[model samples]
Target: MRGWGDIPHFIHQSAGTLRNGPLVQFLNNIDITIMNKPADYSASEMKQISKRYTTVANQINRHRTNELKNQTIIFNLSESFANPNRVPGVKLKNNPIPNIEKIKKRTTSGIMLSSGYGGGTANIEYMALTGFAMCNFAQTLSTPYTQLVPYLRHNPSIIQSFNYAIAIHPYSSKFYDRGIDYPKFGFNKFFYLGNKKAPIIHQKKIGANSYLSDETAYDNTLNQLSRHPQGQFINLITMQNHLPYNHLYHHISHYKATVPANGTIAAQVENYAMGIHYTDQAVAKFIKEIDNIDRPITLVFYGDHLPGIYRNSMKKDGLKLHETDYFIYSNPAAQRLGAKNLTKHNHYVGPNDFIAMTA
Candidate 1:
């Protein structure tokens, strides 16, 4: 848990274009199919279908809005960004330990910041985020023993070792298409200008390196991170909740049931809930791993933003969108050792406020 301000020195770069990519194309198709139905359809039929879709969409949007609003409030309350006088809690061996000075000193020491849109944002956004985090962390640490290089070259082992060492979980890869660059170590960088519609591309993927899986891509990242043993903090961004609702839903159907009315709003809500449930399961696994770690570790897990499904629902329900929701769970080992029950910290907090709360 290095202090956010003390992160190591690192350069931040972005690549690729935002528009006309596979994701944008797919989203456009979905929008057209839903919003541009033939005008010739019977008014009664249209009314029935619209009512259902709108209902579901509205419910989702309301949920998202509420979540956003909550996050905003929490962010406002954080001392890290707003109030410097407020000290973050430090729990060692699970007790309400008063080492605020030590925590603050350790946090601000040698931290680096390399932020970009894609990787921190979602799966398709991975190319930018993962590459940047890895490169920056690597540059900071002295290299590990040279003998480990050969084992690191093995793709599967490389991926697993890197992730495990950094405490990054496997399911985090859902936000981006991993393995877009295999064999080679690079990211599928995408860029979008602030005022312009198109992207400025420099390097693009070619040859057999194009077909990488999310799992493998993550593995590659872990491999890269593992090269630096001196780098104490490795912050990872995951994309397990990115869109194409139906596709994401499929993976967690076991936790969900068919909607009663088939194409009705209630059904859509149920499906969305099911997807969230699956994400929860993934989070649970991460928590379990943290709890089992032999050394002291602080795990901070939270959503970057609420899912788009919830945004759509807000429109249908006519609710004003507001805050985002986040939760911070400590390792069970910390609890066992006398850590305060920080689970009660489950409240709406913005992304920026996270460092303050956990600092």
Candidate 2:
């Protein structure tokens, strides 16, 4: 987990945009390179590599049994949705995410060990979609969407199992080069703010919040779902709970910290909690709506990473800071179709394992 402030440096050195330019030639001569070296393998070795990846892709494609083919799978990549109690010496007056807590008790829920602590959102998204871990990549490969996706010939992803696959993010599509990379990942369309193919249908936001609310995200998702009679795969990355948490909610819950902290950090935590509180309400409502639908549907919801607001408690929390809440929930209609069998009972997992665990 590196600071996002250093993204420009990573991009300048690793992005494929420099390909076929003098800069690349200069870097190559100096023993520095961004583009991956062409595979140095004999015909037999190439055949083996091809076979390995093909086997993995085939396994994933065949994992979704016929009974589960009609089930719509929605992956909700919630932003900065972490448990406040996990932070040392911090306590809230009331449970901020009671709805999520209740759902976790009944559903296949657990902790997801995230790749990034504060801001590696795209990497987690990549892991969930492609079933590839960031840890397996070179340490210099910080943002694969820019550094790797452009150069890859094929992208085998969970989306291949569905007839229709779309991505919904209530923010800029250009971030992390998603607009350019989504098609490569088998997505049919991307719905984001001002997207030309399919614009974001819902744009409602919370009080003083710069990002759209989870309610609106769900609304837009539901709208998209209504149009596709065939089961669809939706990758929804929410933005409501993103950074700059300053007193965004009308009703701010007071969080009493045993260890003294600055006023700004305290307010950020309170505002972030309130944000998740709204997400809880929205999630409960969304599930209720899914329950009433005739079609089978399953939602995989989890936070991308913990917010950067807890600088004070980072060292104390350690790896706990990289763990966020997640659950694999099937609607009653899907449960009746044995969608419940798709998930394993394991209580802890990594984002890279989600495709295999759920499919």
Model 2 per-residue lDDT tens digits across residues 138-198 = 6656778767786688988888888789999989877888888898988899999987779
Sequence-dependent TM-score of model 1: 0.35
Error of 2 at 6 (Å): 9.3
TM-score of 2: 0.84
Question: In candidate 2, which residue pairs clash?
Answer: none
Cα RMSD to the true fold for all candidates: 23.2, 4.8
The stretch of ten residues in a row with the least summed lDDT in candidate 1 is: 72-81
Question: Model 2 — which ten-residue stretch has the worst lDDT?
Answer: 1-10
**Tens digit of lDDT per residue, candidate 1, span 1-359?**
12422222111101111324444433333322112245677889989999999998788667332221111011011000111111112111211112222332323111112122212332111212222122323322221111112124432222221222222323312122221222222212211212122122122221122221223323333343234422233334433334333533343333333222323333333344444443344444444544454433444433333333332333443221223223444445434543343333334333433444442
Q: Stretches of candidate 2 above 4 Å error?
A: 1-69, 254-264, 313-315, 341-345
Candidate 1's error at 200, in angstroms? Answer: 26
